[model samples]
Every structure is written in C-alpha cells, then in structure tokens.
Target: MMRRLLWFSLLVGLLLVVMPAAAQTTSTTAQVPEAVEITVGDEVEGALTEAAPSAEYALQGAGGMLINISLISEDFDSYLSVRDDAGTIVAFNDDSNGERNSRIVGLAVPEGAVYTIVAESYGQYIGSAAQTGDYTLSVSEAQVLRIEYTQTVEGELTSDAFSLDYIFTGSSGDTVVINEGSDDFDSYLRLLDASGAELFSNDDSGGSLDSQIGPFVLPSTGSYTIRAGSLSGEATGNFTLSLNRIESQAIAYGDSVEVEFTNNAREHYFTFTGAYGDIVTITADSSRTVDTDLTLNDPYNSQVMFDEDGGSGFDPEIDSASLFADGTFTVILRAVDSANGTVVVTLDRVPPQSLDEGSQIAGFSSSRTQIPMLFTGVAGEKVRLTLTSPSGNTSSSLNLDVRQDGTSIAYANANTLSAITVEFTVPNDGDVNLLISEYSYTNFQFEVTLERVG
Candidate 1:
C-alpha cells in the first residue's frame, strides 16, 4: 500500500505539467481564478495558501501596457509569473523588488492577448514544500523617469497622492537645483542618491508653500533620484519641477563666453584652464539693471578671488596677472543685490610678454593721453627701460609709473628732457604694468626699450 501511494503522488505531479497553469494552483486539488478585469493604477489585496499555492488574475486587454506586479508576503518567500491564455509562460520573478517579496516592473505585454498573473510561494515552484500567506498586489503604470539639463516638468498632485520621480545624471562637486516655485500646492522635494537613499529633503524652503532645494552638490557622477511630492498626502494641486545644472564653462585662452542669470541669488560658473603664474582678466557686461558680482575659485573649489564693484560702473572685473595654481579655474557670476539680468562675460589670459636682452617695442598714445603696457624680466637681472617721445622736447612731461601685480615698483617723471629712463634690479619673474600718463597738453608717439644687464 505504501509503494502504491508514492507512485500515485509522483503520477499526480507529472499530470500537473499537462494541465493549464491556472488549474495547477494546488498540488493535489486543482484551482483556477475567475477571469477578472484590471487596469493600471489599481492596487488589489489578496491572499495565497498551502491549499491554493497560486492565485491567477486576468488582465482584459492585449499587450503594450507597462504592468508592475508586486507581491508582498510575510509568511513565505513570494514568487510571481505571467502566462498567456494558451498557458505559455511569458515572464517570471522571484526577488526583483526587495527582501523575499517579488515585483515585476516595466513589463510590456502583447496586444489583443490575455495575460494571467500568478502569485505563489517560491518553494512551491521548486518542490512539494507548502507555503501560504496574504499579499498585496499593486498594479500601476511604470514610467521611466529621466531629467536633463534645463528641463521643466509639470505635473499634478491628485487624490491618489502620487510621487513623481526623475533621474539626474551629474558629476561630483556639481551643484544642481530642484525648484517648484510655480507649484500651487504645498510642495515638497527630496533628493536620493543612486541607491535610493535619501540625501536631502526640503519643504517650504522657497519662502512659500512651494519647494526649492539646491545648490546641492552631487557626491559622484551617476544617476540620482528627485522625488516631487506634497507636504501631506491630503494636499493636492498642480506643480512644476525644474532641473538646472550649474557647471562652469571652460574658457580657453583668449576665449569669450556669455552666460545669464534668469533670477536673483543664482550663480553662473565659468571655468578656465591656465598655468601657474598666468595672468587673467574677466570682464562682465550687461545692458540690464543687472550688476554682476564675480568670484574666482581654484581647482579645489576654494575662493581665491572676488570682486563686486571693480568693473566699469557696477560690472564685475578680475585683472590678476599672477595666478597661484595651474589647473581648472572657476569663475562665478552672480547678480548683485538680488538683481536678475543677462550678463556677457569674457576671459583673457594676460601673461607677461617676454623681452630679449635688448628689445624694443613702439606704441603711440596719440588719440589718448594715457597708455598701458606689460613686460617681463628675470630675477637679479639689471633691467633698464627708457620711455621717449617723438620731439626732443615737449610742452607736456610724460609720467611713468610701473607696477608689479598692482604694487608700485618704479616711477619717473620727465620735467624737461625728451625721455624718461628707469633702471632697477628685477624683483621676480612677474609681469610689470606701465602706466604712461601725459602731464601736459601734447599728443605724442612713444617708444619703450628694455635692456637686461647683470
């Protein structure tokens, strides 16, 4: 009798292979789910048991619907599978979601085809081990969220209280902003790293019910998550989410680039790659009421230079001829005093012009009375520079003021002679600026010569 019972059990298991999957929900007693219609955004509660190892449901339509089947079971490791009406297995899942539960997301189904969703104990799929539990099945439209630079997304918060998601790909030390200023509802924002761990969250940070979280630096170059939500589950209204990437514009030598600030308290960054001891000047111009405030950051994001009122009438300027480092340099442009406007920025690398042991360069300050020039000399080298005019004697005396990085180094005034000469030992390997100003009313041509002797 014992041998006969074991043979019958094995025969019954073999017979299950030939039966419809919906009818094979139980090991011994066959059970099938009644055909039920379901749609996206629908969450249903159901249970499974040892007596009925699987539950089958019908999705009335054909394929092309992105279906997400989630099975939550506390009593057993859950498993999920989908099959066509003809009992052909289409998809399966064991632990794609989390823990021992199962979830199948973003599965595209066929058109005009009926699919059977089956939930079962993971053990039952392998052998005769019986498992039972209650589970919740969530069916919703799975959307692929992607965020790009300067993108604006508009959405609504309805009674369902859905959380909108977006994926942001960024680099380390990059600052980004998530703004919901146009949201009518009490908005909330949350930032998550690639692993879905919360990095930051903000509510009512924009001075109103809307949300704004930013100047947030990314930890690495990868995908990050931004969740747009409401202050509470009950609050619902329309909202707009905007993503802005704050990265420096790489300004090469003699390159001119333009950037704008759409609003106040926003920072625009421009980067330039230069060598150590290089001199650079940045000029910001705007036609609007926008007064620019400029800040220079080294490769390590450290503040090395700042200017708020050094330009032509409220514009920002940076005219440093001696840079300390030789890497990426960041130039930050901000609107002054909470003003918003467009600003055109240009960067010029102004290194010291190299002169030979005895070289001469001629220039004229004819149309203007003042001229500025730059030159370089080596340390310990006795350098002699002579500034002369066309006439042997002029009514106006020419004044010469030479400076190294804004510090006065030499000065000369021609009272009655045709030329002014200044000879001094080179202080360092830096550039010197010559400010030639006329003290009298005379338009004159000038020649500057430098001779090195030591």
Candidate 2:
C-alpha cells in the first residue's frame, strides 16, 4: 500500500510541471500581455523590425483621454498604426520613404476598449525577436484653438488727387486690438470709390486676437467691397464688416460761363482780344483736358495754331493765344472728349508785338543737291516756304536758314521721305532772309509755315 501511494504522489507532481509548460505555450501564441496597467502620464514602448498584421491595447479611464504617439528610436524604419477592437484603423503614420525616425502625434485611443498600436518597418521583419528600434505612445488632452487668425493691408491708399478706395470684411474689424491669441494669421479689408480708387484699409492692427471681428466703417457709404485672406498666405479663417450712414458732398461747375456745356461732357473755352493786339495766356486746371487746336477768326481773316497736352491734369497752364492783328477776333479751342466731366477755363492778356506781312520764298532744284538759298522777312510775321520735288524719288533732306540781311535768325532741317511741319518766331519784326540746302541725293517735297507769338 505504501509503494502505491509513493507512485501516485510522484505522478501528481509530474502533472503539475507539464500543465505549467502547456499554459506557457498558450500565452506565447496569444502574443498580448495579460493586463497592461498604464497610468495617466506613463509611456508605452516597443520595437518593430517588420510589417505588423495586427496589434492591440486597452485603456481604463472614462473621458477626455489623449494620446501622443512617436517613434522612439532612429535605427530602423518605424511606422505606427492604431486600431479599435473591431480592427478598424483610426490613426497611422508610415515611413513611406524608409525613414528611420518616422513619427506622428495626438492620436485618440478610446477608453474601456482595446486600442491596438501596430508598428511596421519597410524592409525588416517586425516582432519580439527581430525588432531593432522602439516606438513610444502617450496619452493626454488636446488644446483649444488649433490656429489663430490675422490681417494685413496691401496696395496704395492714395493716388493723384482722389483718395484710394478701401474695403474690409470677414471677421476682421477696422479697429482690431491685438492680444495673446492674435499671433497666428492675418486679415485684409479695403474701401474703394466710384473711380476704383482704394481709400482706406485695415489688417491685424485692429484685432484684439488673431481672429477677425466686426465694426468696420466704409470710406463713403455708396457701394463698397471687402476681402479677407491669410497673412502667411496659408491657413483658413473668416472676417466681417459693419457700415454706418454718413454725409458727403461733391463739386460742380456754376452758370456764369461764356461757353456752357449742358451735356455732362468735357469742353474747352477760348476768348480772343477784340481791340488791342494783345497776347492771351489761357490756363485750365489739371482736372480739365489741355492741348488741341485754337482757332481765331475776324470778319474776313482767320488763323489756327496747335497747343500741347498738359501732364498731371492738376495744374494745367497753356499759352493759347498771341494776337498781332487789331480787328475784332473770335476764338475757339477744340479737343477730343477724352473724359467725362466739366472743364474750367481762365484767360489773361499780355503785351503784343507789331504785325508785319512776311515775304514769301520759293526754292527748286533739278537734281538732289545742296544750294545756298536766301530770303528776307519781318519779326512777328507769318512766313511760308514751300519746296516741290520730282514725283518718283522721295528720299531727300532739306535744310533752311533764316537771316536778317546777313545775320542768321533761325535754322531748320526736314526730310522729303515724309511730310514735315516746322514753325518758328522771328526775334525782330524786321527784314529777314532765308537760305536753303540739301544733304542727300533724292527728290524732296516740303512746306514750312511760321506764326509769330507775342
């Protein structure tokens, strides 16, 4: 009986040893730890050297759990993927280019359920035996306000006499007061006039925070536009604008005018001296157009002269007339309607010189040659010179010299290849003569006219 009991005891001990070995094999095949107890600030680390088909873990908390995941080692390519109990992957970062230190952050893991974190390596086997580097996963809550907003102004606010138009809209207000939260982005606003001019603008300077607000005023309240964009040219946000009623005024021409234009079109006014052979200087404000043909006529005689266009329609001053005849003369200046508006004209008189009938001169050449031709004339008198070339050949150069007896008063050169116009004034209203010459071997056609100015 004693021998049988001894044998039975030995068999029971052997069963205990074999049962523990079977349990160890089962645990190894499962691959997951029985109970992973992780605290709020603790980090879990593991290594992976190859692609993982599946992985998992579980949290114990009830609410507001956050996770920051990262690759902890730089030796092998590390990629992280997270999945819920049903095997749906919720977060992942892969080292697509085989980078050794690939990482991503703030992946949320659900509480009370198994959250699987799978690490993968591009070219190496990943598991407990073949893994080469460690990956870290952490948990926490995320902060509010992912990105702040801002504003900025672009383009000029003023040009010429009119103020530029500006516009401001979106969440960005006109008077933004910047604060700690106003650092991430920018906003834009502008106010434009009827002429498409920008008058005012606002950006980040008026905001309390980076995000936009309201209470922006328009330069003048007819119809204004607004736009908003990022200061760094990236990121997404919004802006807005508020408008109030305001009074405005505009200027217009009055009724006390010699030549009145009833149609809202631009016009020019010209006046001629009726008694004295006086010089008249006509000045128009830059707001008015200048440069055109000024024509003067008496009962039997009339004359026309060219005036130059003015720059910067702000302060336009043109010497429009120089009268040498004593008869009653009527004047009119003509211009193309380049703009829409009323133009104002002002006229004043200066001293004039005595008139004289200039002597007519003519020149002819059989072949293309330079010859010294001379003629005489009076100062402040209209002088006309004409040259006719044979029809076929037009390439030639003509030079003219005007002199008082032997003293040269003026010289001019012209081309027969193209029609030329030359006008000059005589220094003295006395006997003036002219000399003509050529420089090229071709027939020429030319005409010259001169009107004196006082």
TM-score of each: 0.33, 0.25
Query: Which parts of model 1 are misplaced by more than 4 Å?
Result: 1-44, 47-142, 247-454
What lDDT tens digits, residue by residue, belong to model 1 across residues 80-199?
898888998877888755568777644556567778888788888786685887888777765647878689888775544345667778888888867775446677788877654578
Query: For candidate 2, what is the TM-score?
Result: 0.25
**Candidate 1: residue 75 Cα off by (Å):** 22
Write model 2 residue lDDT over 349-419, tens digit each, in one string.
54322123332322333432333333334556555544434343454566666555345656767654433
In model 2, the runs with Cα more than 4 Å from the true position are: 1-40, 47-56, 60-62, 96-99, 109-114, 123-137, 143-454
Locate the minimum summed-lDDT window of 10 residues in model 1. 359-368
What is the Cα-based TM-score of model 1? 0.33
User: Which residue pairs show collisions in model 1?
Assistant: 62-112, 63-109, 63-110, 63-111, 64-109
Cα misplacement distance, residue 54 of candidate 2 (Å): 8.0
Best-fitting candidate, measured by lDDT? 1
Report the Cα lDDT for residue 106, model 2. 32
